[model samples]
Target chain A: MGDARRALALVRKDLLTERRSKAAFNAMAFFAAMVLFIFSFALGPDAPGMAAGSGQTLLQYLWPGLLWVAIFFTGILALSRSFQVEMESGGMEALRLYPGDKKAIYAGKLAANLIILGAMELILIPVSAILYNIDLIDKLPALLGVVALGSLGFAAVGTFYAALTANLRARDVMLPVLLFPVLVPVIVAAVKATTLVVRGDLMGELWTWIRILGLIDLVLLTVCTLTFEFAIEE
Target chain B: MNHRAQAAGSDTGRRVVVEAREVSKRYARNWALKAVDLRVEGGELVSLLGPNGSGKSTLLRVLTGVTRPTYGSVELFGAPPKTSNGKRQHLGVLPPQSYLYGELTALENLNFAAVMYGLKSHDDELVEALAHVGLEQAADRQVRTFSSGMRKRLALARATLHDPELVLLDEPYGALDVEGIGWVDAFVGELREAGKTLVIATHEIGRALALCDRAVSLRGGRVVYDGPTSSYEGAVSGATDSVRMEAKR
Candidate 1:
């Protein structure tokens, strides 16, 4: 079979299983909403007095930080569960036995995590804007673009680590510990880019941050694709 | 490394399908398999019998390319097994535990394997496989709801759903009942009749001796006995009687 076809089949299998079980979706979606709500409370009802005539409140300043924090935690939850299914059922060995470029398996898993996280972000973005009381309609496209790139970075590394840690008894705790350090570049670039895009500065620092995200994603995707065969093998 | 033709219903003109030369798998300080040499002819039901931790599973893993032998060469279909997906596609493997997802239905589990094997249409094969395993009525039921015996049946169905030429099963009768064991014997018979090769790693020496064309016994990662199943007692001497009785029980 062609690599692309096998990748598609794997993705289809994952999505169909997720749809039927709703295990990851239910837990991830609920956790994402709770994170947003908690941030809303933590940010406080009264807008803190930051800068007069600066046209931004403390909540606005914290938007990028809080949003990425939410995504980081939620992404870990979703990615961990993605491979947990395979590990718990011993399906990883079976998947490794599939005939094709093994990279296709990694590609399929990365795409599935991206889709699940992306769908959650779609819901979280609007609700987050409402809770944070920020008007993001104008910058929505740019913000989403940055988010997509940053998410690709997250999925790339997260998918690799998820497979690495799947067999560990401490996988749930180990995943964040191993993943967060590596995700520093993505989180930094995403926060900086999202802040600028949300602040209506699309042509200056935003592009630089976007470029950084793209570069990180490119590097991580290549590295993960090259190493996933080893990660899943015995 | 000669090639073998494995078309169904043709077992004559025996040819080699699996070849292992001085295959040794070492882990840390322990050797799992030490200088083991084995060759399986096409269309043979070869049972690997051994006690706990006797390297049956390790050898099976080596043959299936799930693990690389530490110090020797192994091949399936006349080539090193590790690098070729095409050869793996023509092979089917079942470990002791079921690998099927509990959330997926019986049909869905088979469908996943069919898709992985790049089967264009499995509707008919799916039905036949399910029926062959006597899981037709439970085809739409989630695997989690099935009993252990049922799950084993479903796993067998899923493994063979792709019509693989060689089947490698490790402890295939682990969770089976009396009827399930009978079913497995019948299934192996059918496979032998169809000219498909099989390697079954099992602890049940009596059943394996009764069903397999040949038997290979391992002790402490080394082959202790390899010959016709009928003369296994003579090959291993007095120790075989106790192990065989224990296995029968």
Candidate 2:
């Protein structure tokens, strides 16, 4: 119970800090919008599908993958920001001094990252959908489920690696380098599930993809939670 | 050589609360702390005096298990830090830097600490803790707007909010103005009066000598002087430029 309270306190503290500063959020939001805009422009305004003559533009066909790419890239900012705040304020050591299960710190950080990523995704989905000319109103329910699972998986590894590299001098470059490889399985699972949500699952494989994503999230979350203490230690 | 003092006065007969046996800490190629041993009993006030880079902060960090010793051991309540994790509920540490978020209000910072320490969050009590540090008036103001002294005072409040039995304050009086230094002095005196076991690592030689029951001076990461403050007072009053000078052969 104490650990739980500590975790909740951490979440509250992190969110309040982020809300007041808006440093990470603003940068991530702008970057996500720019990624979408650049991709939409590069894909050349919905030209006929190059590889598939299914009467869909290249952007429409690739919307799901492109969206996740943007998310993962911009999402790195949110994940890195999670631990950056601690470093900037010189609070990490002070945080470790607090008595309780160190796992609570991991849990708290993971929760805060999820909330921030969730908010970004909320705005992101609508903006990207309008840009890609895809209808998500009907797909919103299913899409949300896929996004949530993918985000959990993403944030799980993200929070872990963020802490692992928090002390590094080259953390800005290292976060993605270390995170992306470990996140391969999660990325594959998340993108597949999201693709099915965006484009109709003709083979009815959405559940299969969702299940894989869920399992990956579970494993990543477990491993990250258990090993978090080591990463955050001096 | 390690010095073990059976502290006299009221601290006598108290159980040992902190024990560091031949503790040595190495950072890469640098030996920040050499073989050093010290025991702090309950209700005892011990001052760890050292020059810069003499391993005072490193020793405090090792004692608190914030950093591990490269050699030897540190125990709290007669167990290693890992097994004694539960005992840390009664331990409080104030690091050199104020960890208070500049964006958060004073009350909110205390509230965060209360929740982290697993203490019940009572607004009235939180305010009282702030008031104890003369910060109740600044309770709602953002800490970023605070002066260094104000931040240090708030850090003190946050540290003791859990009513910890063993409080380790690193440089408690550093970076403070005269008034702020006096405030810290008053606060430390109160902690001593309340019989709280304390290990303060600082360069405030005079203040430390006056308030501490025992003095353990460190040089080159080794205990150069470990004795009661009364005897050390005589050494200081002698023809010595500084405590470190007397510590020399």
Q: How much is the TM-score of the A chain of model 1? A: 0.95
lDDT of 1 by residue, A1-234 (tens): 478777887788788888988888888888888887776677675677365776666777688888998888888888998999898788988897777788988998999999999988998888889877889888888989999999999999999999999878999999999999999999999988888887767466777888889999999999999999988887
Task: List the global CA lDDT of all models.
Answer: 0.84, 0.88
lDDT tens per residue, model 2, B1-249:
223343322355679899898899999898888888888899889999878998999999999888999999999878888678788889988889998888899999999989888889689999999999999999999999999999999999998998899999999988999999998999999998888999999999889989998888777787766788777755433323443463473
* B97: Cα error in model 2, Å: 0.7
Q: What share of the true interface contacts does candidate 2 keep?
A: 0.72
Which residue window of length 10 is worst by lDDT in model 1 chain B? B1-10
- For each of the candidates, what fraction of the native contacts does it recover? 0.72, 0.72
Q: Which ten residues in a row have the lowest lDDT in candidate 2 chain A?
A: A46-55
TM-score of 2: 0.95
Tens digit of lDDT per residue, candidate 1, span B1-249? 101111122435688788888889998898889778788888888899888988999999898888899988988988888766688878988888899888888888888788777776557779788999999999899998999899888888878877889999889889788998888889888888888999999988888998898888877777767767887766666555544554465
